[model samples]
Target: MNSRHIYHVDLAPVLGSTFQPTGFPDVGAATFTRFEGGQKVDALLVESVQSMANRLEATAWDSAADRPVDAVAGLPWVRVVRAGSAEFLTSSRLEAHRLASPFVHKATVDGRPMLDVIKEKLGLAKDTPLNRSAMARAVAGLDPFCLVHGVFFSHKEWLGQPKFARASSAVIEAHDVLRAISGGRKSDRVRHQLGEDVGGTAEGYGSVPFHRTEWTAKRIVASFVVDGELLRSYGLPEPVADLLETLALWEIRVLLTGGLRLRTACDLDVVSEVEARRGPALPELDELTGRLRELIGQCGEVFGDGEPLTVEWSSGKKG
Candidate 1:
């Protein structure tokens, strides 16, 4: 009765103890508004996925050669430059909101409309009736740039907003705790390095705001509610579903690796009704990593001859 579908996850970050605080200006250091704080956490999660996407941009099937292709050939998904909409994942689906459609009447990255660029790249006639769907799929097939990174992070609530983020289902609660971080004191700076009058007042750059984190120790952690039932309903292949879950977890792993003063919960509390009695409560990530290899094994041919490969979607621990 083991269901690989992940239903819920609980994570608690031990800041100051091991990891320092991690706060941002968007939500402010002392923001108490739930919505605003949620928005900030949502933004972080979304961008983190984009970061993962950037790291994993190399996955595409070359239709011409009937084989896998290079990263430059296409990304695993699209990332609409700065002006394009961004994507966010939730507990049940993926959602998107247009940042700004400035490209509506203007050209993007070139002196032509996006359709024209896609047409030229695909070697299609300018007059070809490339509808919106066709155009999107075409662009995704070739570059995935227009698809927005991590759009494949589906099975959330399918919710989105323009100025605010919507992560109701996935994130039940989030905490951004502040703490005293270690750093250069103004007196230390003036005495050792910049003798007096660095800032013309013996303050130097040590006392500047934003330049140094006032609250050096910050902890950002959240409790999530995932639904394996909903996740499994997406109808994707088992490996692919697991891959998405793995990558989503990997995004956190990448951001919270043991470094700097930012410590995070490496061990995530995983609870699934599938392994109800005792199984799903604590599943090993190593098992999932082993499964991701099927993808590599299937495409090792395109991977230049005699190259040692290590496909690591690294993250840690279980709470």
Candidate 2:
């Protein structure tokens, strides 16, 4: 069977002020709609490419159209930016596209399609279209490890968290095993203190930390074993397994950081007990909220439903 192809596009550059004339807006304040099987599911506001470009264009044209030609000349030139792109091939629909794309396509992961796994695991109807709402809920409910690892693998950094260092180490370790396995080489140790196959160690046993704080060369080996076990258990392909590991790391960071932005608008002057009951402080609260909301909305426009040029939805869910 042919593997499914998943594509990732970075919309940051396309949603910038320079792309405004092309109808992109500031992504933070746009509403997003997710669709499955041509039906709408869940919707949310997020930062998207289209919204960001549109907003920037509108602001410039509305305020500067009538200004003197020379006055506008001093303004900064706008340009569309392209962040990065990656492609993966897998068997499972959910695993193929995973969270990497705005839409999902039917594919196999570990020799089984995602739809089949969903039916087996979640008891979802075979004929049902994975709509946005359902998919979003599923993603939200995914094992924090899988979700965080996926995110981490895609990008080296998340909100300033250092995940690349760990991922790079894992990749190198995996490569070593792949090479040794291909070479029919045998070592004396059973399970090395690490999770990998040592010359003389037992199967499925290794010493390493499962959490990020435990990350180390030995832990990397253990992580590899854990990854293999997860792949076999979940029927995920090697690529998908790697993606999940990265995402798991990212999730940990997100959880540790709380939400995307810190709440810096706390009140002062009141006693501790009274202050706890109070809401955000004045202008700063309003300003930060507005900015975040705007950015999220823009994200929605770029990746949301209802746009023909946009990607299709997999299981119903809004990011």
Candidate 3:
């Protein structure tokens, strides 16, 4: 099997409720009662902190400490969790933590807005506010949810076994739906219109020269199809194909949340590695194609089919 490194990161928004030093309202009441009954809350607090610290240390040391530095460094899977004030590096302690630290400006993971990250990563002018808005609008116009699905489908092995197949199916189904919607035509005008409709741009929205209409829905859909094929070429089960798509979508979410957007080609390489590992499974493409077609047919039946022409017309009308 092609062994590739996969990184999964989750950034959970912190609510006021979670920040309370005490567990919760009920827990606080229980603690008060315990105090009234002469029980020590200090001991409990100490135990809880100790447990948390131990868990953190264990997680940090889990894979990095035992494996050779070069081997661990090159392995594909990496996961980082950013929740509230704490950042947890689930896979590689050194690398994951290093990548995560930049996000932590001051006490909070610099929620400077995902747009800023996009601008910086893409090398947009610092003072170009209107251009930034236009770029942001363009991205927001595409189906944001599918980006995560794409990531999952592109990186199947990273997903736990139990969820592998179902996740793959969902992504493949979504891909079929998107493809049918786009009619396989990649038009800059169509993409620009999608960005305007989905992202809401104003008349004066200065255009970011790098922001092309082609970066919208059609490109994403095309990437999904290519990634799906690549996964199938790996002799990975349909489930794995689906999982990588989901991971792609997830990576999009993470990038967006961090105020960033990725080049389509940049992400495509991330997905294509699976196929590169074992070489092309082109001889098996016919079987894979048939399975995907069957999956698409089943999905249409379940989700309610419409004439592709009619759907395209409706999309145009809506746009």
Candidate 4:
């Protein structure tokens, strides 16, 4: 009975209506709908592994800080000093909403854009990381994206697209196909959220209409990979390997339990790697969570004092 290494869980999230992913329309992620009972549901188009990483990082930070923070940074405010030189001003707190905030000045340093200067300064290689910053921010109760997701160039892949990235004819075919699909799109309901347009309005500042039709999916399955070998390298305590596997399952359960608009099931059985007994009332979950809480806290410190994020958890009672 060698049941020790389990790393992933498959979750089936049922969407209410169309839910938009963070990616642009060009992605054209594959979708599956209307399944007959027990028809195999493939994990259609996983969000890039990095996306999940960001979610994890963001969750850890948010939990520790007990505040809403974005994983992306906002644009920087710069002022031109010379014809080709600019003085950098303050930028948006990394917590501000944005996908990629490239505040690099048009100015050059050693024939390179100033953005390079920032990248190097932050010790951001291959894009992100800030050690011990999260706990400091958590204590201060201040929110910032870099403190959470770490600073990185999100559009790096698009910039890295090679010359042969798209064949001469493939581009044309893609555009035609995309245009065809982009047209004739309709929605039964449009999601509306209050928004403001300080820059574009007849009045100096006014609210801008915000609307989006969520791209609903019949079910979304998220998979997490466990690094068994890495766990062994740490040479952690009794059945620590098993504990990590169990934690992965709990993390998924907690995320689903978050008030996401869609309905989702933790689908722990899909995670047979740990052999957890599933039920409405599973004290084992709390026990495992508490152990993980202590373990993670001992490591780099767990967000919000060895408890869960966003929502409160103390004395087996969520605050």
- Write down the TM-score of every candidate: 0.37, 0.19, 0.17, 0.35
Query: RMSDs, each prediction?
Result: 13.4, 26.9, 27.9, 15.8
Please write out the lDDT profile of model 2 over residues 1-319, one tens digit for every residue.
1111111111111111111111124643222345658875433222233222222222212233332122112211111111122222221112322333223223233444433443333334434543433332233233222222232223221112112111111111100110001112344344555533343234534443332110111000001111323323343433433333333222222222222111122111111111111222112323433433343233332223212111212343443
| Candidate 1 lDDT score at position 312 | 15
Best by TM-score: 1
lDDT of 4 by residue, 111-190 (tens): 56544543343344543444223222221121222222233334443232111110000000000011111223232233
Ranking by TM-score: 1, 4, 2, 3
lDDT (Cα atoms) of all candidates against the true structure = 0.31, 0.25, 0.25, 0.32
- Model 3 C-alpha RMSD vs. true structure (Å) is 27.9
By TM-score, is 2 or 4 better?
A: 4
Which candidate, 1 or 3, has the higher TM-score? 1
Model 1, global lDDT? 0.31
Error of 3 at 225 (Å): 10
Total residue pair clashes for candidate 1: 20
